[model samples]
Target: METKELLKKVKEIELKTRGLTKQVFSGEYHSAFKGRGMTFSEVKNYQFGDDVRSIDWNVTARFNEPFVKVFEEERELSVFLVLDISGSNNFGTRLKSKKELMLEVAAVLAFSAVANNDKIGAIFTTDQVEKYIPPKKGRSHALMILRELILFKPKHTRTQLDIGLKFFRNIVKKRSICFVISDFYDENDFYDALKIANRKHDMVALRLYDPAEKELPNLGLIKMFDAEQGVVKWVNTGSKKVRDNYTEQYEESQQKLHDIFRRSGVDYASLSTEGKYLMELNKLFLTRSR
Candidate 1:
């Protein structure tokens, strides 16, 4: 993309997303993710009906007046977006590719995080750690992330979900809300990593898919290509048996993903390229809030 065009796109996205965050998602986002815990703010003179346990004896002694310690919920939070940039994400039969949708989703979530006064960061990975943007708060920081998403080119084209999670675990010491955005086509054992991360930090998996992945069209005897493996083959889509077997394989993969998420106790949701992402996200936000 040209510099002028990229700047225009970034400004457009910022205008749209910032408005949504301020007007719509900010409240829901805040309510959905709770703070880690409360922290002491200050001490003030005890007022009527104050809790006895909250009284500061030393402060009271020094001031000769009943003083109590005041605490507030630590509202600040850190959000880590574990993004997948494998070659498979570049294919989509719908309005936008999986990579394109990822940029918008990441933008909205990043804005929502900053609107709640939280730090936002992301890891871009494709079979390896491509880049890691440390957590920071502000619209400028969020714009920088969006720019990277729009223009980043990876050195590799394969995926390693576990590698990204392990890096996230090692770098971020504090508990954070981690959103793993990916097609999740890898065969790696991410269960242990997920369990470890979820035990220490809150983790949510956003599975991105295109409708063509679930159902194949009847383009009889057409050529098919695997984006990741770069393999081409011809299949008779007119044959019912062949179509059925292909569908079964797809469903099996979906079920396996579902099972992994269920057993891991991590919140997971799927977004289809042909459908409304915001509606699905709102449902997930409300579900988490409840």
Candidate 2:
């Protein structure tokens, strides 16, 4: 894209996502992902409904009156967006590509972090770690990230999600809320790495997919391309056996992905390129909040 066009896109995304963050996601996000813990704020005179356990003995003794320690939730946090920029995300059969949907979802998350006054960062990966943007706070920083997401290109076309997870584990020592955004299309096993990463940080998987991937339509014979492999083949979409096999393979992969998330104790939600992603996100947030 040209500079002017890119800037226009970034600004548009910022406006839409920032508005959504303010109007819909801010409070839900805050409730879903809390800070580390409570910290002492001040000591005040005890009240009838106050918790007796919070009474400060030192302050009470000093003033010869009942005083209670007040504590406030530490609201500051670091949020990381781990993105998959592999070739497969560029495929979508509906209104937009999976990559486009991923970009919008990422923008929403980054804005949500900004609304919460948390530092936001991103790691781009495509079978390898492509780039790492350090966590920072401010609208400018978020816009910079959006720009990168729009213009950045990857050297590799394959997917190895473990590389991204391991890179995050090494660089970000502080515990953070990490959102791994991808289609989870990989031939390698990343379960161990994902589990280890979640051990130190809260990990959430936002899987973006296309409906065509899950079901094959009766479009007769068609040419199918494997984005990651950079290969093409003719597929007989009208054959019932062929369509059934395709659906079965997709289901098996999805089942395996779900099993990994469940066994690793990581939260995840799958969104389709043609469906309402906002609703799915809202459901995920509500589930986490509870």
Candidate 3:
């Protein structure tokens, strides 16, 4: 993208997402995350006065004894956007590409953090740690983050969220609310990494996907390329059986991702490149508020 075009995209995202942050998302964002935030302190044997809702079901099931999750209320907070920049992010059949939607969603969250007077930082990754911007207050810092995001060139084209988590844990010492923005295109076992990160910080997953990812249209025989692997192949999209198989595989992958997050008590939400992100964001905040 040209310099002029990049500036325009940044300005446009600032206008739209920043406006929503102030006009629409500010109230709910505040309500949902007004308090510093919560981080897992530990899980110990359930005591007599422990709240039943705090029971750690998984721990209890594993140990054959009741354990209650303990959380420490944070007094100060930072927001981190751990973004994925794999080659696959360049694919989109919607109004905007997956990369565009990811940036927009990230902008909204960053602006929301700004409005709440919280420090915001970012970690860019594509199978490796690309960059790290330390958390700081001020809209200038936020805008700088947006600017870098627009022009960043990653050295790798694969997705390895585990590396990003390890980098985050190594750098950020305080309890922070982390937003992992990606399509999560990886087979690497990230569960251990995520669980460790969650113990030290509040982790939220923001998944971005494209409509064409789930169901390929019947465009007859067409050439398809593996964005991450750099493999090109021909596919029979016109075959009903092939389409069904594709959809099934996609849905299964989605379900496994959802289950992983939920089992670890991570807040997560998914949005399509062409969907109304504001509505989804509103819903996410509302649910978190409850």
Q: Give the top-scoring candidate (TM-score).
A: 2
Of the candidates numbered 1 and 3, which has the greater TM-score value?
1
lDDT of 3 by residue, 143-256 (tens): 899999889988888999999999999999877889999999897878878889998788988888887788889999999998888899999999999999999999999999
Question: How many residue pairs clash per model?
Answer: 0, 0, 0
Which of the predicted structures, 2 or 3, would earn the higher lDDT when compared with the native?
Answer: 2
Clashing pairs in 3: none
Residue 26 of model 2: what lDDT?
Answer: 59
**lDDT measured at residue 106 in model 3 versus the true structure, 0 to 100:** 85
* lDDT tens readout by residue for model 2, 67-154: 9999998889999999999999999989889999988899999988888889999999989999999999988998998899889989
Question: What TM-score would you give candidate 1 relative to the actual structure?
Answer: 0.89
lDDT of 1: 0.88
Cα lDDT of candidate 3 equals: 0.88
Candidate 1 structure quality by residue, lDDT tens digits, 1-290: 99999999999888877776676675678888888778999999888999989999999999899999999987889999999999899988888889888988888899998777899999998789999999999989999999999999998888878899999999999989999999999877888888888989989999999988886678899998877777898889988888898899999998999998988889988987875777778778888898
Local lDDT at 62 for model 3: 99
Question: For candidate 1, what is the total of clashing residue pairs?
Answer: 0
Candidates' C-alpha lDDT: 0.88, 0.93, 0.88
- TM-score of every model? 0.89, 0.90, 0.85
Flag regions of model 3 displaced more than 4 Å.
35-75
Residue 239 C-alpha lDDT in model 1? 87
